[model samples]
Target chain A: MKRYFWLASYPKSGNTWLRLFLESLSHEGATPDINAMAFSGGHAAVRDEFERLLDIESNDLTDEEITRARPRMYELEAQAANAPLLRKVHDAWELTPAGEPLFPIELTLGAIYLVRDPRDVAVSLAHHMRQSLDQAIERMSNPQAMMSMSKRFIPKQLPQRLTSWSGHVESWLEAPVGRLLLKYEDMLSDPEAHFGAAVRFLGIDADRDKIAAAVEAVAFERLRSEEKARGFVETPPGVEGFFRRGIAGGWRESLTPAQVTRIETDHAAVMRSLNYL
Target chain B: MQGDLTLCGWRVRSALALPDLLPWLGGDSPVDIDISFGAIPTPAEPPLYTLPHSTLWADGRFLLHLEQVGKFWVEKGRRIVLEPAEHADESELRTFLLGSVLGVLCHQRGLLPIHASAVRINGRAILIAGNSGVGKSTLAAALGARGHALVADDITAFDTPTAMLLPAFPMRKLSLDVLDRLALPHQGLIANRPGQPKFHVPAADGFAPAPLPPSAIYILHTDRLLKSCAIDRAAPAMAMALLDRMIYRRAVGMKIQPPPALFLGLSKLARIAPVYRLRRAEDPSLHRLDALAEQVEAHAAVTRPLLAGSGTE
Candidate 1:
């Protein structure tokens, strides 16, 4: 049986970058083809997928009803899976309405949770959500933050309930299960060390040279060019670009001190523990 | 089994005298299907398709189990054996009966059912297709509000004989939020199912009982980037692909993996009727909908005569 793992993170964190790195290893090329990444056609919350698997209309289902059937959906995906699958997930590590973990441990082999500097995250999220820096910071600060909740039509994935960033990080960290955390800053500072560590943690035995090539292949410039040449599927309807500037601490130039202070204050403990400070 | 009825171009006999289906009563033609309020007899053959809640095997037999609600056995594309859970509400059983059970039955009979809402335009069928909750029913309701006859809601089946779309239930399912936005009354309507925000609005004002010949298929999409509505026609090749996607529960249908007849049927439909991509504004309202319906009407006025002259049928 093929094992399932989660490429899990809070949105705009290094989730996509990490996936590209993994795809580079899979493709074993000079540069990872941005379009050639092997995930399901999309992330974990696809409505059409749920309905297709369960043979029920997901839109007709209440949010709680979708949540109730979510674990079963994962199981079915595992059953139907032919290869080792790494499904992308943005939802906080949480439980379904039935009190089962939304992403069940029984179905999962492990997860790679990517955490980024909350300060830089504020700047990127502002652009991704099309909100002011202050508004994005406020949204991130709030424990009840969510995406695609105010949608006018059926969202592709089910509504992802992300309690605040602190809660999101802690939920995964606090859970005693197969989870490996990778700081985005670490990947930037030492791509070879961190990326290879992640690959080994996920239990893939690859040549060190090949792993180094995978890291080199997913450079920020190459990803942005690919998004420019062909639009990204995950790009929201009006977002200018999904592959925004992939620099850390660019937040210093963009975020007002007050905005930085707010994120720091909101997530101070997690920052210090994750060594973001 | 009791008195049988015909709706959505299928004859159905059921044990329950469902009030929702009362309006669609009195079809004495040869029984195309049956519904019994009891346990189903074992199929003479082993299950061809094994699933968690349902089992389908041997020439269109399906035993569907709706968790905590009901268990249904759709047999040989001709009979439905229903056993509702003790204390299962009317709303629960009917939701599956009208949606998936009937849809799979149609698929079993080698019919192509599209996930769309439809209305009669210029005395012909104009389909509004989209993913679930893409405002298919809302657009169909808005069109119906403009006095266009509502032909089908949710599942619109194709009749190969006439090369026309067969109308489904004479009701449009609208979310309560939309009903509030439109200021439509909800005094006597029933919620489609328990705990669901949507209600089944009976098509009392403008409902079409008979099947109408094909005219056009409008695939609906909402673009946040687009400031206004844009309707673009799909070329023939693209239209065929779109029709394949428009199949109701397409992934589930793949399990049965209908024969080439399904593709031939859908491709034939695509070749004759024009398919359009209608992208609308992010925030939809009655005014925007009025503009959209007008654009579609104007487009149809030009194309209907062209379609009639083609003589492909």
Candidate 2:
């Protein structure tokens, strides 16, 4: 079996940028229909895949039932042979009841973890959820509320949100897997360099020119425009767009005076470490 | 002599020949064992004139120092020699030591190791868990700077029996870049063999013994431009999702055979503690922490009475 590579991140922490860059590098020829891919939240593709395999609607089956019926589904999806199977998961690693990982850990050939400044993340999340930076920080500080909101908004398969900004990243950094840590600032500063490094780490071989072309092809602006035009939106059920503004450091302008101080106090060390504050 | 000892229902082989490694053997008992591989060092006693190997045992752990060799063990009366190689090229030995020594200790104690930064806010314990670089330490430090007690950083031990989160040994190793960002006082950086920048902070100023009752659990998510900060209750499914991400999921899974029961318990806990998704922009304002602290305190007060009756199965 070809090992799968997981592109993991906290929501809105430059995961899409890393994904697009990797997809560009791994592109053999022709743009594969992204709609056909299986994602954590969007149900259309999963339903279609299930119906095609078992001749049944997905809503009728529980997640357990789907797991039992997954082998056939996998076989059916494999018919579209040209594209490598790419799975996007937001869940953290945990073992199944059978003492096995919910997903196959051994099949995880590699992983790419993208980290961003939490202060910036807060700013972006505020805009995405239509909340103020102070409000976002306040909600985050309250572990109970954070858990409540996550239960309301995030999916069941995904991992629970950590109470602190730093706790979120530490989970993946300490995972027992080979992962390449990609900084969003570094990727934004020089997409070519970081993207190429990520591609190389994934064991994909492409010349510098090819990598450069791919990097240029998947610009953030291009993706945003593509998302807008194609209506390629995958927001949480009660939430908004997965892709908000693709710019960096918007928190400076977006956060209120009180919110800025709160975020600084909450994420002072992290912001300082990343030079965001 | 070799004997079989049952620990947590797992039968482990114990041999007397490996005396140096005996002190570290952990069980649910308080008995302390001591041994010596060669010359035994005593208090007020000079160094052994020509000792070949020495082993010291105290408390419940043992230390072995070999003159020409390093630490070694005899599994079954068969002498095993140990050689010390060059340190890791990119990571700190202290991290490894903590992970190995304390990690084993906690595992033996039926405690789960969690990847989180813990601190006390207004007498309530708050745990921050996320992937690396999500600003856990930064947030913990920020809260610490604001008078919240620092219980532990990077690793937290969840004491299942006590239904409390215990503080592991404290070692705050902040990067220089982080120090510069926070503008906090710190000693100079210590150059490990691989030359990674590690600065030390006083563990005494922040360390707290005994676990605090958990008040809230927040799953921190970042965004480029969040509109506002608000506290909302997490749905049962969402609560399950978040709990699934916790490091203790495996242990919990083992305990709760049918996962739905676990999810339901998490949902109840969610009800008892307010859970929220903290969203913000890339360059958010600094005062956000104050807002967060206020929200947390308010929520904790309301939930404390309700949570008092909630029991862990």
Candidate 3:
């Protein structure tokens, strides 16, 4: 009984959206806030849980320190080893500390790769990060900073972020994992079709009408409204804004003309390939 | 013409022409050495060595291919290639190649090459075996600091005559954390690659040329600390199972082959080796060298008379 299902994606590439969709689809009456459960987003509740699990004073540790601390974190999280453990990870497909491949090419049952137009990702990231479009563009150029920033509160680092995105998606697609590549635009346009495809890939008997309703229930407006009305629970410090403007192409109006041109110039190849340009 | 030499129990073969050695070196040799030998000639360049594989080396002979990229040594195959470059300071290149090549050859010969650290206590070999990052090197260093001589770390080559075991090499590789914990100077840490540090610790005094009659083999586990230092004897079947886990499975390649008969012989040898699963706390202070040495010495004393009587019969 293989129970672990890795929910992997590059940062801010619609992984949270997928999680919310999954949360809604997996349970009908259970209104567990998807934002609170997402590992990537700045949800106060999940941040506290991650910090306690890692036993770190803060998330400001260096990459080397984080790598050393990860094994202990995994051990602590071992109790959550219930069947179909929907694990969220940002690491590239590689062997674990024990020398066993984490997702062996032979046994990878299912994976979902969410890719967004790099332009929109850059745009949305700049607004969410509270940084200028130019600063975000520069951050994306430096891979080390990008990687370090991913562990922190801000998502300003672009190169490391995008590289991770490309690497994670490519690894699963190439591996024997039954991978489904769903674009952010496609999901926003037709959540039911894409979510259903993801469900079928997982070998689940999901009904279309119910899944569509769940998707609607977990829409960006619904989550935003919930965040606004509830005053955002202070579950974890250093991680706030459990829900921001969860809209696609939000970067268009937010980024200046020069900023847009710079991002397009910087990640043009990737954006063009994904048809974002 | 000049090459590094080390004394071992096995016989050494003749050195062939550099050109002729190219194909034998194959992909395992250092890239610089491979190019210098011109084994795989560039489109514009002519081939330097073209001797047939049969004319160069005999089958079953131990050939050492030391590649330049990592200064690695490949042993126990028909062909050997050495790469060029002079970055001999990096310990990982040296250890990785030496272990990988020797591991493949040992597998072919039916001897198991364990990813372990061994030491000589009371003139008997006590092996500390475990998976990578399991503190084998750290434990070995602790034992070494306490006056026990180091045998090998990361890779241990085993040679058995009939059923008695003998030590092959005596060196240990320590990670940065272990080195820091031991308060050892930073001089031994070699930067072979970016962000990866490999520490080389020399054998202790009176430890050279010290091959011990095997007394015990312990598989070390660092995950959970044991209440006390306990030695649990392993059954023949269980010993073989443990040995199989340590065997370098990657050297076998992709093809399916019959299980080696050497495993059966090894299982019998394991029974004689006094196999034990040593579980200890993650204590950096509890150097078990002297205590373990005493235990092996006692076991040897009891087994010696029986071994002699059986030989006489």
Candidate 4:
């Protein structure tokens, strides 16, 4: 049987970094080609996988219909998988319209939810989306915010509902499943300790030395250089880069006081719980 | 009212109106397939092959259930029974009927269904094949704009012995953005499903009805990092792999047909058709399509003389 796990997060929440580290860990301390991580399962919202597993064209279905079929898609994927699978997901943990969990609980081994300070996320997301800082801040706080939901063109991936930053955090934290939470700041400050914990949580049987090597292989500087060498595949067509300045608290310099206050105000209670306040 | 139609050379007598197929005009032939409204029984035994939303039983029975759409049961490749939802729209039901259900029927009958959109270039079929959303239909539409007649869209089935291409319905499915990008008129476009950006456009005048012999096949691909357009002729080994990957509803076909049988059909196609990989820089607006279309036409014209005596028939 194949065990499935989710690397869940809001956008730009160190999800890719964790995945990179896991890739290095699994491949015997070798840094993976940044552009070649497609074998690392894949994104949860990839339209091709949905269409392939469901045996129907996804463009013919509404977003609501797509969401309802996602759990089944994952179930079938896990059943057919020959090895353990780790899938990255940005959709907030919630129920479908039919009141079933959006992610199948029975097939999941666990989930690793990576979270970041919304103020800092706003800065990174602004660059990623090529939006003004104010626009990014507004989107971060909007409960109804969705990604890849374009009206004019059919997006490559299915629409993912990323509720308000706080809603996203709270939804994953409170969901009834096996889960581990890691802060981006904490991972940056102590890679060996945090990433080590995640490796052990997934029962990878890696020692501290192996975890340290994996961390060094995917260090922020190496990742940025690799991306700069040969453009990252995950970067959108017009985006300059995907791995920009991996740091915590860049919001202090990047965000105006008003923008910081808006994120804090919008996400105060959840931020307080996660110690982001 | 029952409608008599011919889809991919199969005489179909369907209770549902399949606006995509050509009306059956030939005299006195047995119906190859029958479709109607009926209650589909819930399978009590374990499914032989199962997808997320569909299943194929050991007895050659298939069932597909789409949320908010309906359930479809394809039995022995000869009949299709549908039990639609209370709020199912006619267009939504017909969309799956013509797409997935027909794909199943083709597999059951042991035909090679290539997931491609083809156009007739000088009365010879040139297929642009790829996965869904890879712009096969868009490229076919672009070729149509360049004076080529559309042979088929999405699912291009062929008779294995003669390697003759069967023309699908005279229609194209284009997303609203594609229509706007290509500047094509979208009047009377029927939405494939509510809230979906894709619409089915009637292409009656620009459609080619006759079965054409395969001349060339271009597998469409896009890369954001590509600096310029690249077209590479695929070797025989690579062509076999590409054609196998381009098989429509391949998993269902694999379950229905043995490997040697499938291999024989693909080998025949790979031997006869000249296949190439056509790549362009990814652009959502399809702005690069004009250049790509011109390149294809030029390549086909240059290769036409060589293929004329090749005897694809």
Predicted model with the maximum lDDT: 4
Q: What is the lDDT of residue A174 in candidate 3?
A: 63
The DockQ for candidate 2, computed on C-alphas, is 0.03
**If the candidates were sorted by their TM-score against the true structure, best first, what order would they fall in?**
4, 1, 3, 2
Instruction: List model 4 lDDT by residue over A1-277, tens digit each.
Output: 5867889999999999999998888887788877778446478888878877777777778889888889888887888899878899899999998789988888788999999988889999999999999999889888999999987767778999998888899989998889999999999999899999899888898888888899999999999998888777778877888999999989999988888888888889999998888
Please give the range of 10 consecutive residues that has the lowest summed lDDT in model 4 chain A.
A33-42
DockQ of predictions, in order shown: 0.26, 0.03, 0.04, 0.53
Reference-based lDDT, residue B60, model 2: 17
Which CAPRI category fits model 1?
acceptable
Compose the digit string of candidate 4's lDDT tens values, residues B193-289: 8767788988889989888888888898777667557889988899889888888888887888776777887777666678899887777767777
DockQ of 4: 0.53
Q: Score candidate 2 by TM-score against the native.
A: 0.43
For candidate 1, what is the TM-score? 0.81
Mark the regions of model 2 whose C-alpha exceeds 4 Å error after superposition.
Answer: A3-83, A87-277, B1-84, B88-91, B100-104, B189-194, B197-200, B225-231, B248-274, B283-306, B309-313
Q: Tens digit of lDDT per residue, candidate 1, span A1-277? A: 5667888888889988888888788777467657656643347887777777777787555677677788888888888888877788888888886788988887778888999998888889989988999998888877878766643344556778887888889988876578889999999999999999888987787888999888888888888988887766567766889888998899989987887888889999999999887
TM-score (0 to 1) for chain B of model 2: 0.59
- TM-scores of chain A across the candidates, in order, are 0.95, 0.69, 0.71, 0.97
TM-score, candidate 2, first chain: 0.69
Ranking under DockQ, best-scoring first? 4, 1, 3, 2
**lDDT, model 2, position B293:** 50
Instruction: Compare the candidates by DockQ and give the number of the best one.
Output: 4
State which candidate has the highest TM-score. Answer: 4
